[model samples]
Target: MLKKITLVVATTLLVTACGSNSETAGSGSADSGQSDKVYKLKLAATWGPTLTPFIDASQNMAKMAEEMSNGRLKIQVDPSNKHKSPLGILDLVKSGQYDMGHTATYYYKGKDLATIPFTAMPFGMTSTEQQGWMYYGGGLELMQKVFKPHNIVAFPGGNTGMQMGGWFKKEINTVDDFKGLKMRIPGFAGEVIAETGAVPTTIPGGELYTALDRGTIDALEWVGPSMDIKMGFHKIAPYYYTGWHEPGAELHYLVNDKAYDKLPADLQQILKTAMRVSADDMSVRTQHMNAEFLAQMKTEAPNVQIKTMPPAVLNELKAINDRLVGDMVNESPMMKEIIESQQAYQTKARNWGKLADYQYIKDNQ
Candidate 1:
């Protein structure tokens, strides 16, 4: 009887162990279908890896997406070098060649004039105002409408608060100074400034410093101190004028509509939130970086005199900008709607800001 009991217990133990192994083997497919599966995406940026603020935005988004998704969703960011197509990001993303792209909306104005207002305008809203308008005052809606035709979804990636006007070899003391001046300024601002006889030319980023140094271009407007310091523009052009052209030059991320639509609901949320947070982060980081570098400029690059464009010069530019915008507004029904929407929002926001932010600064300064 004792031997019979021992044999029965051994048989039961073996049966239980085999059952557990079989269950574990069956669960592997489910694990592969769920938690063990990974999704990889590719992103392209208009900037190289080291370019601050712009490239920082792209890296920040990728890092956050991977962390938040527990490694399920991964994004590989490729800069201009890897792709060798900086100017074609919009078209690439539009055609679903890339999953997403980081670039400026204004870069594509030749294809669509309506893209100008999304980035900035001469004498337009500030970074604060533009951001507020985007989140609260239907600016995002208008941006989407403009980009929808191309099958691209646009989101603000970062902003360069208020860029310095440009670095010039000579001071722009009078409107007459623009006469016969050649500047490597592009976009709508290029058109506005052209009215003043400052012939506008478009040059690639790599060639800008050489162009300025060799007198190929009399002046060029890059970003503020953080970026400008690295370019050594201060050594070549002493006059650093404040901005009017791009009060808030906002950078954007372009996602292919189909690629975005295919993301799981959770991943879609992660991407959107990550982009929003990183964009805000980029704004604050850029401000800090610019401040740090601007201080360095004062001590190290003292010859880099920071000056504002005289009100007279600003007025002239403003007038030309208004006319150009007016012509754009009359072009299409959609242009009229987008421009009108921004102008409407600007009117309401500027008044409150005037008393709140503008007044405080004007009084304190």
Candidate 2:
């Protein structure tokens, strides 16, 4: 009886050891999976909450990033004014102070003039054309070259399709009226405005409303009807103008090179995909909002006058813009490359525009 009892106890002990080993192996595999995972990122943007589409897109990007990573990667976005000036956002991202940022490429002209092609030039391609160039015409690769030295990876984020010409306290009936007008303009456009006998000032968006209200600025140009309506420009400045000069204005999302490189290959792809989605969503939202806002403005602000800039004014501005581009190309080889690429793409795209976009607008009008 004693021998049988001892044998049973030994068998039970052996089974327990084997079970323990199996559980250990399973735990090790689970740990290996956990070790491969990473966590959240931080993104920044210069625009405020009032820019609903941008804010919404950014939030969507964060959500998508988290989902794509299976909760391993997360992105936290903050307003630029909360941390740094809008113009300083790109630099902050490049330095790894922020994981990512959204801002205007033109705002960084002092860094590289090639950025102008990525944003807007006087008489540049419309929003759709610019997107085609960026996605297919090698514009994205060239932009990468420009930003590589700065240690940032840039992606097209949002666009304000054709902005207003500007708000004028008085009608700009002719080229002479453009002379001596103090307009709040930024980037290369400011230089072009200066050539037209206007003094261009760079002011933060938050402060622009007050400047215009107080007559500190004689004229001001912001994004489009949607943004203009949100800013309540019609209340202060009764004259609203069309965006002939800036046919399409593009915005960008810049990511820190090191931070981006650290991400897994799948995560990197996720970021790119998120940006493209955001870009398309933003464009659609802006178009719809502008149509609605324009209708609302017409009813709400009946006294607000909407007028187009004179053809003579546009012609002169175009000439000035050409000179500006030439001077910029002379300043840097990168600018030269960008200009060549842009012109090549423009030539190709303009043919389509002439036959389709331009003709449609002309016929419809």
lDDT tens readout by residue for model 2, 116-159 = 77888777888888888887788778888888888888888888
lDDT string for model 1 (1-365, tens) is 99557534543453343233221111121223355457787899988777777888988889877876789879999988889888788898988889899988888888998887888888888898898888677778788888889988788888889888999999999999999899988778989988998899877566789999999999999888978988888889999998888878888988887777666655666676677767877888888989999998999998888899999888988888889888887878888998788888889989999989889999999
What is the C-alpha local distance difference test score of each model?
0.82, 0.77
Clashing pairs in 1: none
Off by over 4 Å in 2: 1-36
Cα displacement (Å) at residue 317, model 2: 1.0
Off by over 4 Å in 1: 1-36
Locate the minimum summed-lDDT window of 10 residues in model 1: 21-30
The TM-scores, one per candidate, come to 0.88, 0.87
lDDT assessment of candidate 1 = 0.82
Local distance difference test, candidate 2? 0.77
